[model samples]
Target: MTPTAPDRLVLVGGTIHDPATGRDGVIDDIWIEGGSIVARPTDPSSFRQIDCRGLVVMPGGVDLHSHVVGPKVGFGRRVAPHLARSPGKPAAVPTIHATGAAYAALGYTTVFDAAIATSAAALAHLELADLPILDKGIYLLAADDVAVLNALDRGDACETERLVSDAVRAGRGWAVKVANPGGAVFWRKGRGDHHDLDAAIPGHDLTPRRLLERLADAVQAIRLPHPLHVHTANLGLPGNWRTLLETMRSLDGRRAHLAHVQFHSYSGGDLDEGSFGSGVAPLVEFFNAHDSLTLDVGQILFGETVAMTGDSAAAEHLAHTTGVPWVSHDLHLSGGCGVLPIAYKEKSLIHAWQWAIGLEWFLCATDPWRVALTTDHPNGAHFTAYPHLMALLGDAAFRRAAFDRIHPAVRKRSPLKDLDREYSLQELCIVTRAAPARIAGLPQKGHLGPTADADLTLYRPDRDLARMFSVPAKVFKRGVLVAEDGHVRATPTGGTLAAS
Candidate 1:
């Protein structure tokens, strides 16, 4: 399904919020031609003009980190069939068609599946073909390959770089991702407690730190648009903040993107519930001082959702603790992934802290451009819950009201209670659009600047931030009207963005 050429048009009199071009809420006209934003023509009568008076316009949304496709996602849908049975609503892990329709209706035009094994990339791409309306890409889990790991173990930097580069090219991936480096190897050998980054993998000379450093160097050498996408060791474990910090420090000034830092930022040791608390302060302090690092807060909203990850050890631990039915698969020596249903309750001490810790990361951070907003998709909450999360960030009063309902101990101990920072719409645009596009190396997708892809959304202003963001009044994908008033008007075949 090839996309037809888009018409030349002018969107007139809209309040634009393109952070990339620094057009912050300015009333202006946007010109589009051949699916890209263009300079106004000298013969203005040749273009079709659409009146956009009283509407707020911004570039389409880009989700830098998410798990919207793959075998793990398929298992997520199977494990929770009831989540999809609700009529007129999307499942937490939606069908391929529903995933794109839901995203487009929410004004998103670009998304990347955060983790896909090199072995599974072809299947994922096939699934992505049926996913319409948003341009998509995947980060290949290249480090999981036994050959690549052997190269790292032998300290063959050239071989390591060549293998990673080959994997990215062969898989048609947008970037390289490492999930709990050496985690699957340990899991296969039934040694799941190797949380120390310096500990050597069984039968391998390389430590997690070395594996991470070598991979980060390879990603840089390959010159892919995004840096190494990392899901560090000891995720969802007590006192994992130390591991997260060590992982960042191990980079040694090399660039890397941390996935779902909220899961890593936690205090306490050995499941001591009383000592468990927010460890965001130290992590945030280090992150603020380092420009080489960027992260997404996998913010957990209280509700039922599925947790899926490339870290089988973390998923197994979670399943064991909850005693819930879970699905885990080993992609023969390449990697493994786990999927299970999860429920975050307000009264649960751990869940409450998770909620607060995520907000703490958001409030403590100084730069919106270095941060991306994600729920880890169904892992934290459904992508549809994004508008609700936006409201929490933009409305201090709303945030406080929700904060008061969580566990009393978390309220007493968490710093979120004292924080009053609220994200302005301009900043919101940066995190959701401009920053993600810049970080993901999709220069043309996130902004409405001249020569950029004509992916933009318009909303009717409302005092309620969530309501205003939940459904855009109009959505344009590559200058074609794809959705309007929460319904998809056109099903254009969106292209797959990949690194050469």
Candidate 2:
């Protein structure tokens, strides 16, 4: 049994990479008291000091976008039971207990389920309660509600704001997420024509563009900490880059967060595999210029993993093309979700292109602070692949070697070949922890400074970025030692972070 954490402790002589406080590779002593980082005590003898000399320290990771729990996640497990267990490997769709334990073991202290229907928020919350160690929250698909859509259609800003605010409060959600906007409405009607953002929803006068604008207005008016979280139209479709670009343009300087942008950054036309390639260059240019927008890569690692999304239409398209086992459920008025098992092969042209495109987005972006590293969790790849993705971003030589092994067509056509920009440890910290926490509106998380939550990870540095990040020397959750050397030492019930 693990002993309870001491109330006063100090992690001494650690090389810290706290980007939020501008401490880059600075050796410092971190003082903790009552589950919070505090200034050094006047009486040094009173605090227990643990020597952390030679170890690298950073804030506990914050996953701003992931689908760790919810009814759809339950469905995903049911559909692919084989994904639940793999000898010496983390499950793609882990059980609630494993999900929490794995994330905590990896030094992630906080996570947000990026796409939970507001109607299923209570159920998601109940599941999250069982997910020990990580402080968790959910982004509600509130825009799918008929009443909200109706208000948006009628251009009733007051009603839209009231309805969105009410749903957020009722569901205890962290932010408002619109998955494919009116795509589900079309899906329910057995129609696949709503590819254009300006196309009308069959039952409503509102287009996807208008819905986005109204939701942004509502989210802003409600004074929510996080902006409207958007998964734009035509996700995973070739030539969807246009839709993604238009989605950003429609925001019109309003604060918003784009989800799984890698899926949307494609240049090819419908079913044109030959024309399919990276569209990230232009997207990155726009993203760099727009301070109102921030994004998570949804980087696709070459692997076998489940693809799940609240965007049922996109899932259906993938299912039909790949001939994989697929499951989709309509959540009545609150939209729908789709889940499927998929294998991204290194030899497959499209898969290789996707891999290159995600990396291109990571490499091309001018600001690491506006970007968050994610795999869209079991969509592009499993969350467990984050360490590997980190290695790809931080080590350009490793990236080139990996790139050379992929499909030759991608080698010749993709722009990822030319980009050699490597992310430093500080940039990695910003993308993984600081940026995500700030984007998620959790200022207290993703930093190791005075008055901040005393959640952090200490790693014995290694030349191999993947090996260094795969296991930490020690992991702390609110000052309590929870994991050490990739083993879970304690299972503590962490608090739920909700937008008040």
Question: How accurate locally, in lDDT, is each candidate?
Answer: 0.92, 0.91
Q: Residue by residue across 284-360, what tens digits does model 2's lDDT show?
A: 88999999999998999987888899999889889999998898877453666999999899999999999999999
Candidate 1 local lDDT, 239-292, one digit each (tens): 999999999899859999999999999998875465888889989999999999
Question: In candidate 2, which residue ranges exceed 4 Å CA deviation?
Answer: 1-6, 270-274, 331-333
Question: Model 2: clashing residue pairs?
Answer: none
Candidate 1 lDDT for residue 141: 91
lDDT score, candidate 2, position 38: 95
lDDT (Cα, 0-100) at 417 in candidate 1 = 92
In candidate 1, which residue ranges exceed 4 Å CA deviation? 1-4, 87-89, 270-274, 331-333
The TM-score measured for candidate 2 stands at 0.98
User: For each candidate, how many residue pairs have backbone atoms clashing (under 3 Å)?
Assistant: 0, 0
Q: Which lDDT value does model 2 have at 348?
A: 98
The superposed Cα distance between candidate 2 and the true structure at residue 2, in angstroms, equals 7.2
Please provide TM-scores, in order, for all candidate models, with all chains considered together: 0.98, 0.98
